[model samples]
Target: MIRKLCIGGIGGVLCLLWGPSGFGLEPFAPRGELRIVDTSPLNWLSIALNVFERLIEIDIDGNLDPGLATGWRWIDDRTLEVTLRQSVVFHNGEAFDAETVRLNWEAYAGLRQPQMMGEFMNFKPGSRLEVVDPSTVRFRFPEPDGAALVKLGRLHMANRQFHEEHGWGEQQWGMLNKAGPWGTGPYRLMDGFSSSQKRSDRIVLEASRQYWAAKQSPRPQRLVFDNTLSRQEALQSINTAEGPVDLVSELRPVEAMSVAQSSFAEQATKRAALVTVFGQLNMRKAGSPWRDVRLRQAINLAVNRQELLGDIKGHGVIIPALAPEGAFGYDAAVTPYPFDPDKARQILQEAGYPDALMLELIAPEELQTQAISISMMLEQVGFTVDLQVLDAGAFQRQTRLKDVDHPPEQRTWDVALRSALDHLNFPPFLLYHDFALDGPSDWVGEEPELRRLYEEILRTVDREQQERLIRQMERHAHEQASFLYLYNPAQLYAVNKAVTFVLHATTLLPLVETSVTDAHWSVRKISGQEGASETRSAQADWNNAEQVALGEKVYVSFCAGCHGANLEGQPDWQKRLPLGNFPAPPHDETGHTWHHPDQWLFDIVKDGGQRFAPPRYRSAMPAYRDMLTDEEIWAVLAFIKSRWPSSIRAEQARVDARGQ
Candidate 1:
């Protein structure tokens, strides 16, 4: 007889007992298909998340989780060794191993593939990958790279068969071929479903039965991504009872409000600070008012971010710079320019624009509402706005560098509305893409101080030093009014109440985790009596003199800035700051640092307090997982434990021993 056993405990796996053949096995139940709607013709993100797999995957809290590779370690400053997950196979049944990694690496090296961060993302010319074993590979770089993991995370690992048949990039094979582009992700593309058959075509994906993580396999048996309807039509369809669309990936404030009121669907929102919406000023344009720093500063002061937030139904954060809060280089101290139309007018008068300065503002159709709002705000403060709206395709062509030989004077628009993804949360990615000399969107021409700072950040592998340099760039950008800093939009999804979907910060639709609850089977929940807390090790090498010394250096460099030089922490550590966040707490015996286990302490330092804290919680502490090694984190913890009194240490050890 078929039986279901709720084995293990809370947060444990649910297994099925199939006629005594096995005690622990996946439940052979039919998981309903999910239908997702988007505005774009081809939802490449949906396909990428479903069909392809990256070397490393970044979670919602910006932690690097293993994807194809189980784990990775730095062999040295210039070398990195990655352990591949074994017994994995691609959709085409090709065994995934070190050789597959080598082939993917070779494909990247052979072709200058178009990437968001440009050529800097690629490995150095002399860099190479060595296959240490079937499931192990080592990457040797010519020089130390602070962005090795960040770069690796973006590299999608396709099989050798894909490369041999279609090569790299979606344009090469995505539309033309249907059976290929095989990947080892949890889902695979359904056969005979061409991505470019028509504008209304839908891409279908099926869950892979041979997936390595069988227990964590996709809940949805099939995923259908449809781009047939417009955003409004999609919203309308979802409001009705018989609509095929289970989820609308994105919705505006007005649409979201409607969805909230509708009985058929509910609104889901996430603080996705991945994409920053800002106005790109053509400062290099000859005789342009934007060339004057005062005018740029005036533009910033003119726009009322609060008003914009209201327009979006309070769905975004008013960012001080291009980078939002929690992102690298985002200094909380650097506040956004307050809305002051009088000051903006005064600044404009001082900059020789006593009368209204007439300028052209170009924007894509997608950002029409935002563009109009900004134009009206600027017009209120000694500015005459000539707004030019274009389709998405036309706007891309307009912003691109027409002639490399000629200066930026040929550019028509004074400012353009644009949004870019800070996917890695690394400041250098934005700096290199937008501000570097002759960069992709080099509207800001040459600036020596900014360039120098950016270069230093690129070279510096030390996280503390890089943070310092990046802050300097942020300050420089703010002072110079590099771009018209706006706000980071929150991703809003309208979903059917019957279906459950978890939103990702990266705006990726992870259908694997999505599921629909119907009459057949519902989501299983374990009893609260089954232990819910995680047990961690109480061990620490506090007695090691060398380790303590190294930890001390690390503490001084990274922690001392906010936590105090002597580990005394902030004066009012227990109390909340003006921003509603608690100040850095002390690591000494007087504080609660010793109350937690060694592994818990290590996790706090590695992942930061933001992940462990509640939603919308703010913390000044930055995650050091990318910057510091595992050994260094343990050493830092050891150093903290060494400072505590013996009695306090003993009590803390007891607490850890009890797994509290």
Candidate 2:
């Protein structure tokens, strides 16, 4: 016989068959809510909902894994075949087939706007994409692109049905007014998503019950991202025993170290990212000194990398070329220009600048300090540097001087400091995109050798030969001083000790496998028939005398370490550690525990430090979700509040009343 069971609160049922041996049924369990703070906007809410599907995803080691397309093979030097995953359904209920793939790529190619993904797809005006079958597609490129697979990893598929019905652009997914561009991912967007062009500061996503990998999807009931909190605010929240954030990522080096030893958080560091910083010169300007290679070299030589790196702390390393070590085309033999002011002066004098030469420098606001330091260094060798700082947006506009709409007179920036990722993980793409004639950022206009090397690198098929060509290209660019190479900064993040998190190579948060292990308050699944009668309601008041008496015993067992037996907290609680975190504070009237509402305190005890802090903030609080029952936690809160004098307790009651 088959037995059917329904899980209440959650709309789902499971079936079990009775055999001679036994019977079993799968049940849905509630995972606690998660709060995260990220420095960069990932359009994460949309990504979480699986509203779009990329062809490939990068693993933690920076290698590609199949995403939507299960397998791929090269048909020829310029032809490729992709085998799609079968029977996948978009969030909107549309079937994801080869035809869907065709429409999405076509839409991307036909869009009038230039896209970052377009560069990787290598789609041109007449490129051909043919549907070989319902589950397979073939792509024919105009030319052989060695990095084709790498580039396709970023090609996100939009549902063709939704696009056609909405009529494109204005009605496209991710727009503030649109409901979706449904995808085949593990989660779905819940209500209350606020959008912004710069970054969506608030987003909420819920795990999809209908997800294809439902059995393996993480236990998180919901994921929340808030980017509006300032560093100090996040830090403060993290130090609070019951603050609301769960994780903070992309922290600066100093901030990461400040709370490194705090009991509030655990620091996880990835020492390298496939990104670099560099300085580009305007070689196209008429009568410009940068047109002379020797002068550019002198400028590169004048700045002291060691001193500049010291200012950056432990964040980065100076290199001679744009490519980071281990990437294709990086040449170990090519080194950065040694800091020698006298040699730089001699080179500049030979290039006809016997006296001080004046030049303009443009840098983004975030890099203003370093730009100023470099300017001072350049001045020491007889160069007059006029520094101009702009917000990130304005700086990017200035860098796109080669665009047709930009006013010709406004392109007066002589030197621009910029940062970028080697997204394709190949050298020829960078050399061609930034320095070749008519290249995207062709500030250097044209270089015959670099162009020749790029074309040769493209034609070569052997990985060994290709790397050799890359080294030659790197050497050529360094010798020409194509760009003043800087360093690659380390990536950092801070996580709550309660949940396990493994970082991804492309920096995507791995939430699918996340779960509640030793948390203080694990959720209990309630059967539909017995839902209301199983246990006490989550909304019960915390002032019950009996519950308070029970809570006193629970607290002594679980929370008496850092909080002190008398609830006085650790000494010097206000003092911050070198890593930037504070000690545990008292729960009595002397501390600020009573300043929060009951719900806030409950969330802190349930979620721990990650719920209230930014991704970089550190803390020592461990979540009690797995260790304590709701009644027991309430009892503990009641016991603590009973210790407060009537005046303080009354004020806290008012705060809770206002919150309601």
Candidate 3:
């Protein structure tokens, strides 16, 4: 049967930019702009995903909810039926139906580009989305996937009519506006917001008037995004009172604190984020020393997790596995490796490395401080460690195994620090992708046990049985010292208190539920209750002895690497060397840090000293915004200040008084 569904477009409606008015902001005609950081899809997928919609939408809590596909049900172990939502229209006046699903799934699968969305979702090969009726579709898979529903939650649907007409490209959406590919999402990309334009610094998204859902939060007249703006530049724009900026997207901890302390932003709020930071040891490469299970265990035992992750400001729970706490496969009983240098040494010696084992440690530029600390720890346990720090892009390419054409030497290091997970709920997916015998990263055909266990979990249909199987796999991997687990950093945002914004677990800003005047009123009503608790916590004296001890703990975890354990920084700290950057300076009296005020030091620690410096200035000191909390920052500062002589502290106290 041939079916032709036509969706009509609504007539033109005026767009009002909702700028901030007084406290009791009454909505006048739209006048303000929403400035967001749309840098890269990899770093900003949360925003891009919100800009588009899938058949089944995964909510902020990571549960499947109704989207283009109204609901779905498993027909059997390998077949599923999905009911589509009718009367939904794409931006191009195309009515959505079951064929829309089929066309989009096919096109997405055929796309030659390496999109983060595609890799993250892990679309099944040979699976087809077939039309059952005008409003229903069915999916037939070769094998039963434990995360089939989760995969469906990631299958974003697009208008077939639009894509066929315009053709495909990396920036197809950006190139064509209403005439190009479109989704039934809440926001529509405004025309002429392309990169080719002379003033193409921004990507504007106006609210969709043709949206089917009822309005919950008062809709923004228009949501303007500036993709070109850096974090530093965005903050500068928000600081201007009469500026067109109404909202500022993701801010680092230091930047948020800076905005809160200054007259620019009203308040900064923190939320728990769903991100993990860990180290992956490549068991595949035969040339790597970590091939021995005993050696891997020794390396894991040598790590002082407390000194590595403790005192981090907003870092949430520190665990042994990448899975979040209470997640399906996370086994709380399986403890993290303790800091035992002696045991590590004994294990290394027993593993046939009596004198010392040599290794290369790979890490991103952001994790240089961590790499340095890890190197020292391994050295203490009688391992000769050489740390290699690469920029984000280079680091990814060097560590990635290119399959048959890519040789062992190209795989670089034995161990590397990385922050990721393929599926948040399924540990088996991560294990399969990174370490299974035939996996890309697994250069050597090792870990038959992990492969066997992961395959078993994939075949298991029962949820309870799946979780139990996952737990068993995680334990086995831990016992083999497969991967060293680390802490999950908390997600945070700094916003103008005028706008009501909620940061979700996925860290995407809730644009649909956000309103300027409405958010202001809401904040005012809840301030008294939430404010009292905040006030009490903020009142803790950082100069006290207890606070100093707290700071010492924080400094050991984060600062001791570059700044030296005794607070005496790197050699030639003041010299601007080959990289056009100075080495990390001492925090003691001998250093110039005491010459500055408390707030000055705080800014340096939170945002990095290079942030406020010249435009292209570089620094090895990574921002501790999401990693460490404000209190922890103060504790670190207090610890540094305590080490200074009384004269230096008194001089800094006078310097701090000038700001008051």
Evaluate all candidate structures by whole-model CA lDDT and list the values in order: 0.73, 0.66, 0.62
Given candidate 2, what's the lDDT at residue 456? 76
By the lDDT metric, which is better: model 1 or model 3? 1
Clashes of each: 0, 32, 11
Q: Candidate 1: deviation at residue 502, Å?
A: 1.0
Better of 1 and 2 by TM-score: 1
Runs of candidate 2 with Cα error greater than 4 angstroms are: 1-30, 39-51, 113-122, 145-147, 164-181, 192-201, 210-216, 230-232, 239-243, 261-263, 402-412, 424-441, 455-469, 508-517, 520-660
RMSD of each: 23.2, 15.6, 22.8
Residue 380's lDDT within candidate 2 is: 98
List, residue by residue over 1-660, the lDDT tens digit for candidate 2: 335454444533544444443654432443666667765544442343244556776656566678778998878877889999875766544568898888877776676542432243355556678999998999887877666665566565666545665534521323323334245666544433433354455655555433555445546666667767865566555545333666777666566665567566667666556667778888766666688889889998899988887776656767778777656667778877799999999999999899998988999876776788889999999899999998877886777654435553446778888766554566566544654445566688768887787777666545577789878877878888877767766566776666566665445565665654445122333122223453434432446778777878877655653576789976788987444566668988899999988888877886676579765454546455544567787778888998888999999999988876
Model 3, 40-83: lDDT tens digits are 33333343354456777656554457887778787887788889
Candidate 3: list runs displaced more than 4 Å.
1-32, 108-126, 167-181, 191-200, 215-218, 236-260, 266-272, 284-286, 326-328, 403-406, 410-412, 421-426, 430-445, 460-464, 508-510, 518-660
**How far off is model 3, as Cα RMSD?**
22.8
- How would you order the candidates by TM-score, starting with the best? 1, 2, 3
After TM-score superposition, the amount by which residue 580's alpha carbon in candidate 2 deviates from its true location, in angstroms, is 54
lDDT of 2: 0.66
lDDT tens string, model 1, 576-660? Answer: 7544567668888778888887777887786667778875454546455533556788877778878888998898888777764
360: Cα error in model 3, Å: 2.3
Candidate 3, 193: how far from true, in Å? Answer: 7.4
